[model samples]
Target: MRHVIALDVGGTAMKAALTGLDGTPLYEERRGTGRERGPEAVVESVLRFAEDLSVLGRERLGTAAEAVGLAVPGIVDAGRGVAVHAVNLGWREVPLRELLGRRLGGVPVALGHDVRAGGLAEGRLGAGRGTGRFLYVSLGTGIAGAIGIDGAVEAGSHGRAGEIGHVVVRPGGPACGCGGRGCLETLASADAVGRAWSAASGDPDADAADCAGAVESGDPVALRVWQEAVDALADGLVAAVTVLDPRVVILGGGLAEAGDTLLAPLRAAVAERLTFQRLPALVPAALGDAAGCLGAGLLARDLLAALAVRT
Candidate 1:
């Protein structure tokens, strides 16, 4: 079977698949990124993982992968195929595309920002499909965003186009890892909600899911925390909507797993904030965690298409 290797490298784990030309998964697997062991180890693990998948594809399907796609977090220089900086992974200016290409015997490779890759899948195959213009926001350990136009996600001139997380919603609020104060992620990310709930509920282990349950059960403290996060998200989103004017906004990531608990209030909050800007339809991402992996497959397929055109 003709297939491509697709990998989504997350902060903690890597999701990989041998994907068919039509985007169906022929084989799927997961492995820890081993970031705790250090960035070098993580890079080795990723290479080994991809090499293993390629071998597996050859053994099981009687063919080698034609291309590879990698989606990673933090700043990316896609044109250069380098992962510029990922604070979570503690790496700098890694030429992942070149490294992977060598590892895979010079197969073509496409490197992209993880969130942008996910948004690409959303725009073409998930919630934002057929929307023409949309924004994808992920509220996970930290927030990030991707702006989708037509069927593709914009990487900006510097590959930092849709960074809604760093938008300061509250002046002089919590400090952000991006070296900014009061960034939206500081107040509205899943990690932020979990920390606030942990403090309020007096349980150091309480997280955003626990907070959502408490809100459903009518816990006043949880309600307050949820509302605060929602309000901050609304502020940041309004700022984005004002400038971009997307036709739709797709929300994803861990915090979005709370579903309507996060969406209901968030919709109201954003609606209340908007005045002159057109209200874009807010929706949940349809592909869930699989979006990034599927998107990587799409990237590989796109690379193959471009190569064929050149030939």
Candidate 2:
């Protein structure tokens, strides 16, 4: 069977899949990124992970992988196969695709931004399928987005197109890692919600899911915190809708997992705030955690197609 190696590397974990040509998984696995061990170790782990997947494909499926696709966090230069910067992984200007390819016997490698790859999968095979234009917002530890047009996710010039998290939603609200005050992520991301809830509930380990549970049980404190986060999220999303005018906005990540608790209020708030811009249908992500892996497979397939065309 013809197969490709697909990998999605996150802050602490890496999800990988050996996939058939039609995007069906032949093998899937998860492992730590070893980021705590430092950047060099993390890079070594990624290369080893790809090689292991390739070997597994050959042994189990009786075919060598034709290509490899990788989706990684931070600022990425996909066209140049470089991971420009990732604060969590301590990477800067790393030639990931080139390195992985050399380790895999010169097999073709397709590299992309993790969120953009997820958006690609969403546009082709998940919630945004058939939607000509949409925004994929991931409300995880930090917020990020991908602008999907037709079947492709736009990477923008300088590879920072869909960074909605840094958009200032509250003036002088909170400090952001991006050196901005009152950015959307600082107020509304999963990590942000967790921090607020923990401080209010006096549970040092409390997270966003706990906040959602409290909201469901009608806790006044939780409600206040949740509502504040939702309002800020709507502000940032409204800005995106006004500028991009997407047909729909697909929400994913840990915070979005709250389901209706998050979506219901978000929809209402965004609707109330809208003036002349068209309201976008806000929907939950269909693929969940698998979107990035599936998207990596798609990228691999696209690379094969382009190579074949050239020949």
Candidate 3:
């Protein structure tokens, strides 16, 4: 049976899976990124984990994997197989493709931005499957989005297209990690909601979980903060919908865990903003974090097969 090795490297952990040709995931594992230790250490850790996975696949699946697909958080130059930059991972201009290819013994390898892979998964097999255009927004510790058109994730010319978090909504509202002020992410991300609620409610150290709990218990401050987040998200979505006219806008990441609390108000706010424009269906992402890995596996499978034919 043909198999592929898939990995999604996040700021916190690197999750890997061995998937069959039919998309059945046979195994999964993860390890801390240890970014504080530097990029070289992280790369070595990833290589060791992949090597172990390759060995296990041969033993358990009775065959070696054909290729490996790896996704990371950053600006991935997919065509060139390089990681231009990943601020969260502290990597810059990493030759990720060549390194992985050598580690995996020349098997075809694919490197992609983490969220782009997730967007691809949504476009191909999940909520946005039938939609020709999709805007996938993820509100996590940080916020970002991806644009998928014609069943493919559009990775812009410079590989920095879907960086919707940097969209300036409030002008000088709040400072962002990207050294900017008043970004949509500073207002609508889960972390932002939590911090906003915490400050307004006199709980200086409250986390996102606390904010969610407070919202459920009908705390006035939490409700206000959550509402504000919804409003900001709605505004951002309005602009995105106007631009792309996507059939569906898929939400993923930590904030999405709020489910109805996040989607219900968001949907209402989005509805109120639309005029004659086609109202896009707002939905939660089905695959979650696994979306990237699954999409990576699919990409690896296709790429390796094509490369084999070319050779």
Candidate 4:
């Protein structure tokens, strides 16, 4: 089978992989995205990454690549290959397909939202495998979710679905980057935990990983901060679970790195809240950060299939 290139584009780094049609990675590459310089800089980074992969694929796979699949952070109109907005990267309304397709000699390009693509990976080869209904949540710099049902990722009417982070939780709590106060993300995200811990401890430079380390050392401040974060996250998960009724809830990204430190408390919180409701099994994402690239590759693979039908 021919190969496809999978690239997950973020504000800070890019993860690229060569994957089989069956969604298996044949080879992988990782590099900094360096988007701080602006939109053109990001496009340039992607071009370089793709060029590297094209060379690697030619040498290793011994086959011409089928297409390119790129997943980007922020609001993506994947159907149109556009990056609508990425405030963190100072990018707006980027025509990713046109740029990448041109760079790769007009190879078909599939642009996708990072979270949905990651969820797609879960559906195809990770925790959501074999389950028709699934929700994959990534807890990192911020929180986002993707819903999959019947083996297809759900993109809402305007290419946004499973955006559970903005839901109001405290109503008057901390402010959020999205111009809301007491939003779910303000309370539940890894950044939120770090900020909350820092505020409570009077340490302006503290981060979530520091708090986690503090927990490991039996620090009351970190323990309390972690519990609050877990509770808020469980609240959001309950809402998602109640709405989707997924067979599995897959958590991935930076926060999930805490492993049992996060999973054990999270499981207990969800179980406690679901006393009178159906509970979904909670699982960690198997693909780690590669999930977005893997899913993006599958998007290209699906496009190839669609083209075949038309032909």
Candidate 5:
């Protein structure tokens, strides 16, 4: 069976799969990223994991992988196949595609931003399926987004296109890791809500899930925190909708797990903020955590298609 290696490298874990050309997974595995051992160790771990998967594919299916696709967190230069920077992983200008290609005996490799890759899967096979235009946002430890057009996610000219998290929604509110104040993620991300709830509940270990549970139980303090986050998120999203005009907005990641508790109020908030722009259908992501790996498989398949066209 001819297959491709698809990997989604997160800050703390990596999800990998050996996938058939039709996007079915033949084998799947997950491993810790080992960032605590340093970036070099993390890269080595990824290479070893891919090599093991390749070997496993050959042993089980009687063929080697034809290509590889990797989705990683950080500032990615997809056109250049480089990972420019990832604060969490401490990577800088790493030629990930070239490195993987070399390690895998020169097989073609595609590298992409994790959020963009997830959005690609979501747009093509998940919530945004059949939609011509949409935005995919992940509200995790930090917020990030991907803009989808037609069947593909746009990486923008500089591969920084869907950075909605850094958009200034509150001007002078809170400091952001991106060196800005009042960025959307600072107020709306899961980490932000956890912090706020921790303070409000006077429990240092409180997190966003706890906050959501509290809100579900009708706790006034949790409601306040949740609403604040929702308001900030709505502000940032309106800014995006004003510019992108996507027909659908797909919300994913940890915070999105709140389900209707998040969406009901969020839909109302976004609707209230809109004036003349078309209201988009706000929906939950369908793929869950599998999106990035599935998207990496799609990337590998697309690379093979492009190569076939060239030949």
Candidate 6:
């Protein structure tokens, strides 16, 4: 059976799968990215990984991949087939699609931002399925978002449309990696919450999970930290809703793993802030960590179909 190679490349690891055009998985694998070795090494690792998957596909299915889809974290210029930048992976202006295509023996390849691709999968196949308009927010080490319209995720004019994390929630507040002060990510990201809780609890190693546990135990300091993060997140979401008017908001990532501990207060806070804006349904992501892999498969299948139509 014909299949495609789907790769979701992260800062620390790569998750890959071989899937049929209909999105049925035939094989899956995981490997460390070796990012500690530097960006060039990481790029070589990705190329090598793609080659390995291609050989495995041919050996198992009697044919190589028809196409390949790659999801990478960074400022991606999908139109140019380049990963503009990713701080964690130290990638900058990497022509990932072209490089992967060459490595895969010229199989057509599609490249996309990881978060946006995950949102695409969620909107079409997971939590946001059938929702006319959706916003998929990932609150992990850093925060990012994908704007889903109909069955697709919109990349926007500059491919930076759903960057809700940089929305300034507090003027002159915490510094953010984006060179902005008081950005939503500075306050609401899992890393940010962990930092705050660590300082308050004097644990030094306290993370968002620990903060959630403390809140469950009715720890006053931990509850304060969690609520602050929730409030900041709600502030950002309100601004997003005021502009995008999405029908649903799907929250995912490490912080979201707290479940209702995070959602209930966020919902209430967002509700209190809204005046004329329509309230969007808040839900957790359905695919967990597998969303990116599934999304890469979807990207490859869609790209192949489009190419066939054009030819």
Angstrom error of the Cα, residue 170, model 3: value is 0.8
Candidate 1 residue-wise lDDT, 1-311, digit = tens? 99999999999999999999998889999999999999999999999999999999999989999999999999999999999999999989999999999998999999999999999999999999999999999999999999999999999998889999999999899999999999999999999999999999999989999999999999999999999999999999999999999999999999999999999999999999999999999999999999999989999999999999999
Per-residue CA lDDT of model 4 for 191-268, tens digit only, reads 888888888888999888888888888899789999998988898899888888888999998888888888999999
1-311, model 3: which lDDT tens digit per residue?
67999988888798899998778888998788878899888878777878898899999989888899988887789889898888878788888889888987887788888998888888888989988988999898878888999888888998888888888878888988888998999999888987887788788888777887888889887888888888988888888888889888999989998888888999999999999789888999999778888888877876877887999
TM-score of each: 0.98, 0.98, 0.94, 0.93, 0.99, 0.99
Clashing pairs in 2: none
Candidate 5 wrongly placed segments (more than 4 Å): none
Give per-residue CA lDDT, model 5, range 1-311, as digits (tens).
99999999999999999999998889999999999999999999888999999899999989999999999998999999999999999999999998888898999999999999999999999999999999999999899999999999999899999999999999998999999999999999999999999999999999999999999999999999999999999999999999999999999999999999999999999999999999899999999999999999999999999999999
Q: Report how far residue 114 has shifted in candidate 3, in Å.
A: 0.6
Better of 3 and 6 by TM-score: 6
In order, the Cα lDDT scores of the candidates are 0.96, 0.96, 0.86, 0.87, 0.95, 0.94
* Model 1 CA lDDT for position 120: 98
Scored by lDDT, model 6 comes in at: 0.94
Check candidate 6 and list the clashing pairs. none
Candidate 3 whole-model C-alpha lDDT, 0 to 1: 0.86
Model 1: lDDT to the true structure: 0.96
Native-referenced Cα lDDT, model 2: 0.96
**Span of 10 residues, lowest total lDDT, candidate 2:** 18-27
RMSD of each: 0.8, 0.9, 1.6, 1.8, 0.6, 0.6
Q: How close to the true structure is residue 243 of candidate 2, measured as C-alpha lDDT?
A: 97
Stretches of candidate 6 off by over 4 Å are none
